[model samples]
Target: MSLRNNPKKSMKLPLTTRTNQVVRRKLQQSSGPFPRQSTNKPQRRPTRIRTTNPMQLLSNPAPNDRAEEQRKLRMAQNRLSSRNKRLKRRQLSRVAKIQHTSR
Candidate 1:
């Protein structure tokens, strides 16, 4: 027998497939358009212009190379020092914890 014939069974039974499809279609229509357009577009980088004098460009490389080498050396030293500082801090914290526990 159909669920409607019994009132108790009708109350417990889930919605029919036809009813579900109608509800889904209504929800989809209320949400947005049928063919959704993408909100985000790929970004294009600005093109670099080569406006420097060719003679100046050839002469400038030595100074730029020296500066770059010095910058790299400073960065490496800073990294090593920072690592040592972190290790020292961790050691101190462990020592403090041990002293606290012992006391």
Candidate 2:
């Protein structure tokens, strides 16, 4: 009952006749290596957007607003340094206490 031994009938066409038909059709529709018509267009360069000056905006800030911003910045720096100094003092005291207790 294998497929190779099965005896189903079929219609057969000659291979050379079929191949010639395909080749003739391909030759009729063949195109050149280079395109027949140019489809590409030249690209335009991009333009830069204009911007306003930052100093002008800062200069026009509401009265006292600029002064308040400067004060806040200075206070932030002071707090950072104070915290660092406090940490160093605590470390030194802890080392000193450890040395005294060990002796």
Q: Could you say which candidate leads in TM-score?
A: 1
Which digits, one per residue and each the tens of the lDDT, describe model 1 over residues 63-97? 67768878999999999999999999999999999
Highest lDDT against the true fold, candidate:
1
Residue-level lDDT for 50 in candidate 1: 44
Flag regions of model 2 displaced more than 4 Å. 1-63
Worst 10 residues of 1 by lDDT: 33-42
In model 2, the clashing pairs are none
lDDT (tens digit, per residue) of candidate 2 on 1-103: 5545664421133678658887887767876322433445457889654336677657565458788988999999999999999999999999999999999
Per-model TM values vs. the true structure: 0.41, 0.39
User: Candidate 2, overall lDDT?
Assistant: 0.72
How does residue 65 of candidate 1 score in lDDT?
71
Stretches of candidate 1 off by over 4 Å are 1-61
